[model samples]
Target: MTEPRTFTLRDDLKLALELADAADAISRARFTALDLVVTTKPDRTPVTDADQAVERAIRTVLAEQRPGDGILGEEFGTAGSTSRQWIIDPIDGTAGFMRGIPIWATLIALAVDGVPVVGVVSAPALGKRWWASAGAGAWSSDERTPNASPTRLAVSGVDTLAEASISYGSLQQWDQAGHLDEIVSLSRQVWRTRAYGDMWSYMLLAEGHLDMAGEFDLQPYDMAALAPIVQEAGGVFTSIDGKPGPWHGSALATNGLLHDATLAVLNPA
Candidate 1:
């Protein structure tokens, strides 16, 4: 494969940031306008609109800025063919968004030859955004202090499962995967557990506030932007079964020290 030099890492990061801005506008408006009354379960129409709008906005920008680069979006599907591809999840936690929870975000990543080198997660409702490049340190900005310098992120140092915290995206996901028992058993072994769900789970893990996060039934867009940030923050990014990279349908992220142990617990013989 020839080296594709369409954009610098910095340029891709900037594009990710711009897409985040567009995503925030679409997500925030639809989120705030949601009825939020869950009759039994959440409705999907609002999120559908938000998802399409955000993705369309991103595709438009990419079409102009990096026409040579390809795009694979959750809402829009795949397009173009450069080895350098943009993977996007316009809203990562549509269930949370529908429920009026502020945990969802827009995820954007630049993956070269199937490895993500740039990532951005923007959650406007939570007033937060986290980003990282292959080498740049993982950093986050709190909406509470927009003018302040971004705080660098690092994974926790907890080396033992008995002293580590974990976030599994959702119990429903585990149950659907027929791994609810495994999740329950693992939860009992961990220091603590929370189904923080979506980008927040990994963000918390990257911040050293949590140690492990895993989820199933995800697409590449959902995991691409998150892998680099977690890895750059001194964590490990792998599939639930321990394969590396974001192509897997599931993910397991942990502080580097406890990654193997967590995988062992989840993938016991």
Candidate 2:
């Protein structure tokens, strides 16, 4: 396929939002439906008819509008050029979604080369959507505030772990990764801790409602959309081991002021 003309980050962000809208239309309708088919992937993760349908919807649009860009999706594997790939987790919390929980989301990201420049996360069951582009501030909307404007997001200013509230996706994940002790120890030092699980933890962190969030056993699609939103909201996103980008298998995110402190605790010498 011939490369499409270059697009600005803002343009990509706009298209990402459109993709999210299409995804929500499919996913929201299927959520909790009695006829919804659920299956287990080779990795033992739950996948539903809704998950595959949502990815197909997004990919269909991307194929028509951004055919030059490649896609790395949870349901459908990669295709096209990586230079301007779109990373997607059609349903980031499929387990919760399959169980009728309102915590799942469709995560979409436009990564130029390897760094995400645009991201959108839409959780229709929760009645919220958030997005950001590099150089554009993060913003979110809620169905409760239908008449109001989108709110600009910024991370909390808590500068110490003792003053910070944090979320760790799942204790099981940490234990499986051999970092259970580290997360538990760090939890004791924080003002509060919750195992919110999946994309919600990171999105809450981006909204400044939570000061830090970390987890292990993540794929690039799981964290790619999140890192951009968190970073644009004045927070930091990196691997638990302190590397940048979602290529790393784990994630550690914090309000900018507390990143080093959190890292030191997690990586105590």
Best by lDDT: 2
lDDT of 1: 0.89
Q: Write the per-residue lDDT of candidate 2 for residues 121-159, one digit (tens) a residue.
A: 999999999999999899999999999999999998899
Q: How many clashing residue pairs, candidate 1?
A: 0
Q: For candidate 1, write residues 1-269 as lDDT tens digits.
A: 98745577988898899889988987898885654332232423344667778899999999988889899998778998878999999989877777678889999999999999999999999899999999998999999996899999999999998898999988999999988888898999988998888889899999999999999998899999999999999899999999999998999999999988888888889
Task: Note the residue pairs that clash in candidate 2.
Answer: none
Worst 10-residue lDDT window for candidate 2 reads 2-11
lDDT (Cα, 0-100) at 1 in candidate 1: 94
Top model number, TM-score: 2
- Our model 1 lands, by Cα RMSD against the true structure, at 3.5
| Candidate 1 Cα deviation (angstroms), residue 163 | 0.7
